[model samples]
Target: MTRETSEQPPEIAEVLARWQETWPTALQLWNPYVSLREPQWCLTTAEAREAGLQDSFAMIRLRGLAVVVDLETVRKLRVENYALQVLAHEIGHHLLVPANLYDYAGLMMRVRLALAGIEDRAPLVANLYADLLINDRLQRTMGQDMASLYRHLREKGIGETRIFLWYMRIYELLWSLPRGFLSCDKSEPVLDADASLGASVLRSFARDWLDGAGRFAMLAYPYLIEDALHQQALREFAHLSDITSAGVGAELPAGMAEIPSSVFDGIVDPREEVLQNAPNHQEADSPGRAKPGSLTAIIPGSDASTGPQQRYMQPGIYVDLMRQIHPDVDEDRLIGRYYRDVVTPHLVPFPVEALGELSGDVLPEGTDPWEPGDPIEDLDWFESALLSPIVIPGVTTRRRVYAEDIAEPEKEKPYHLYVGIDCSGSMHNPRRTFSWPVCAGALVSLSALRVGARVMACLSGEPGSFMETRGFIKEENEVLRVLTSYLGTGYAFGIPRLETEHLQNAKEKTHLLIVTDDDIFSMLAAPRSDGQTNYDIAEQALRRAGGGGTLVLHARAEWRPQEAERLRQMGWVIHYVTDENALFDFAKAFANRFYRSQGNPTCKRP
Candidate 1:
């Protein structure tokens, strides 16, 4: 492509050189990273596109590691009189807007929220919303000539498509441009009225672009859905959207330390290799900006060498995909109809708090705070060394000064959790759709693990068989596997299974939870493995684990009061759920009671 292209005109090259110089000076105050590593120059759109830019023109990518400029587009955009502004605008995508990988994913997800039907337009909408935010910052904050970029586009005789017009009108109003300055020539202005709302939305959230993005996407929804306007919007952003799709399908890049592969649901494009190798492929493709020294703190999955297949399987993603599988299915009903289906939105991805928030006391401050007579464990070396020189024989402050060691507080010890869910014929299979019950169970199980709790997950049905994690463990996938599996085998959860496995020969102090319905009455009345009644086995399980146990039943209040009474007598807490929505809340309340002191909180129940 580069070999086939004509050389960049001297005028365009000179202009790019100026922007290259201007970029460092402009962003120096906002982002020092630009100074350490400057944006690279791509002499043509082909070079820029080859250099990992999604669009044919200018772009900043690789988490601000490099900026790629298509001088050809820059050359044409200059006819509109603000080519450098576009350069700065691409730079803004990296340093600001959805600034980091997480924020970028957040932006994508937020757009997904507003786009239930027109998901094909997610990348495009996200890109446009991002442009508005970045341009607003440049025009309104730094006082750049952002409007000229649009004014020139308008001069090109392109009719203002709704999104394009909505976007331009934003700049016009924001900068006090004339009402009809960015005209569509159509009798009904495509985005005339909403521009005011867009302007207000921009001002109210000029600083918080991510939140502003949600509102902006909502504003663009009507235009997005109108068949003609939608096509026009798509045509207007064709290049950027193509790039977004290209990036979406692109290969994973090495040194992609900021965003995790899991966040991308496996697709990732790292520009480390591309930036290193870019100059070799094209004419005058310069080695781009310098990568910063440390980003392990900023970019997640810096060393994500291996893990279970993870995706952005948030509730919204789940709902979207499920619709693809059963296209005619009602998603709202799917979310609320079953127990496990509703839980997916609330379950945490991991079992343990990656932040390592095990609560513990701070060690007392003092060097050698412990003396010969004092407990040796309490000795503080630093404080004691300082005290020894000033030590006087009669002074009690100096005597015990070295007694207490200034110690880093240890985090709270995590507990073991045992989760048992009913998977009988009446219960819905989680594998079929979004499983709310399994999701609810996961909410508790992950919370338990986050706080350093070992969780034993079990799927149980009566008579034929049951599945268990066998013993306490911390693997989320293992626990989720049990929760997600379908076992529409028996009539009810086998009480005998819990008695023999968890209650009788428990390896650790475990918190037991049983999820079932009123049908569990038969299991409670049935004989256990020990020949004792089911109630007796559960009672013993509670006493042996020493930790409290809970029984959550999804049955009518009047049906199981008598049956639940026997378990309640055994000191097991009982919670009834009339609606599946309340199940997530209950799971969270239960987890907080058990795991709060040990780790950070997970997503709240809906």
Candidate 2:
């Protein structure tokens, strides 16, 4: 659609004039990448639809780019100068404008053919076009004026040579802007009138080129313009090599022999003056002026004064807090906080058993058989109970107990716990409230280790690749260390190979605990054996392990009903806790169910 009436207001007229002058060139530049044509400036949804457009504003191409601007939307959204400029920039793309010398060459060729024979002065036109092209390229590449565009180009793939050429061209083109007016060394007849015409044409061309380029650059590189200053500040503090190496640097890579040595020498090396700037380096590395114990001091803060206070919240605090709330939260119990808040009340009414009762004695429920001579109350007995495996009902088969059960304890076999943790990109939310999987995994590992279960923590990502940590954990510090080292190994697209491999391994009764957001059921159930997913492989392993197979699915707030049901149907006893406090409750319930079957009277909910 045509621009708004010039009679509307002087400010409106000025804006339209500026837009008309700038948009043509910008559109031309963007045309090569995205085809743009006939832009309609709409004022309402009705107007946009009447003009065959679908969005408030969009670059649609029936044949070429058509930038549709909803005028009604502009008023409704209260779009100002910046927004107007952005809209005009999109229109500029429709105009197929050029921003650099190479691109302008094509534009010049088109213009020359269009205006042929009218201007007899071909040499002057050619020279003027060349100069303008160079100047525009230089301004775009090296001048601070188009630094935003340069930054965008840097993010893309523009080389150092192109940037340098852009700068050099700017200087040369500035000299050529007024060349027609200046007296030359080898002068021919000075056609003053023709020269003037040439100057006017060149000025018109330059103004349009610059405006279009600026507008298009802003739109094309929107994020760069907003982030340029911050990025510049970051560059100031960054290693020089990092900022300037190869594609980003002021010079080419080592093997590019065409680059001159003089040009190479200009490349700055912040590391060169290391000896003299040692103090400055140290100062830069020194902790900033943030006070200790403040919020700012905790993260992204100065380390010098804060000491280790903000390094990480003390593990002791976490352990003490867990212990105070759920006194039974020890090493061997799989404690989780998924549905703790919602399900703890439901679980509290049930009789929660302890570890000693599950493994040491076969006492009936509600019967206290502890005597003064009984060794169950001793710390060593509790420690041994913590390490021993308890046979939960429906989980393990009944086994024979030897004299070593109460006397010399049999050495526990380290069980290989293949923990498949979902660390896909979607799980990258670091906020405490959203980090249930990480927290739950940590607590579960701790519980397993405390109860003498040899735990192997594995993060499932990609296909077969998993970060697995084995060996018995003796303390909380070791557990945290392993957990902290677990980095997200990118997104997973298929069922993890571990699931299949775990099913294949027949030697040991492997307990595979999959801590995930329950999105893998479809993939896992693909090759169902008798309409069952490979979950039977896990169940069978647990059965082989005397019924100790455990599958714990830690869910987020938005639970998938079908997936949850499928997991439950697959024989996974789901412990759903909503907060950290409930993790202990879940652990206590789990311990009581499995650990107190032997009636040692030591089983109690913490």
lDDT of 2 by residue, 319-405 (tens): 322332223444222122221211222231322233332346443222222334445332233323343566332222222223323
Instruction: Evaluate all candidate structures by whole-model CA lDDT and list the values in order.
Output: 0.59, 0.36
lDDT (tens digit, per residue) of candidate 1 on 1-606: 001213443476576666666766556535666643666677767776666654446655543345566666656544313445665676676677655554655566556544545665666777777777777788777777766656656765654565676666777777887766765433244355566666777787667766666556656666667677777776666544312522322222212212233333211112222434666653332222113221232123322221112222333344443342234555433332222323334444443333533345444343323335665555444455565656443342232331233334434455577788988887776644344467678778877776567898888887777888857877866777777777888888887666555556766667788888877888778864566787776777788877778888887777857777877778888888887656767886777666655233332211
Minimal lDDT window, size 10, model 2: 240-249
lDDT of predicted model 1: 0.59
TM, every model: 0.57, 0.29
Q: How much is the lDDT of residue 398 in candidate 2?
A: 28
Residue ranges of candidate 2 with Cα displaced over 4 Å: 1-418, 428-436, 470-482, 490-510, 525-551, 554-559, 577-606
Best by the lDDT measure: 1
Leading candidate by TM-score: 1
Compute the lDDT of residue 16 as modeled in candidate 1: 67
Clash counts per candidate, in order, are 40, 48
Q: With candidate 2 superimposed using the best TM-score fit, by how many Å does residue 452's alpha carbon deviate from the native?
A: 2.5
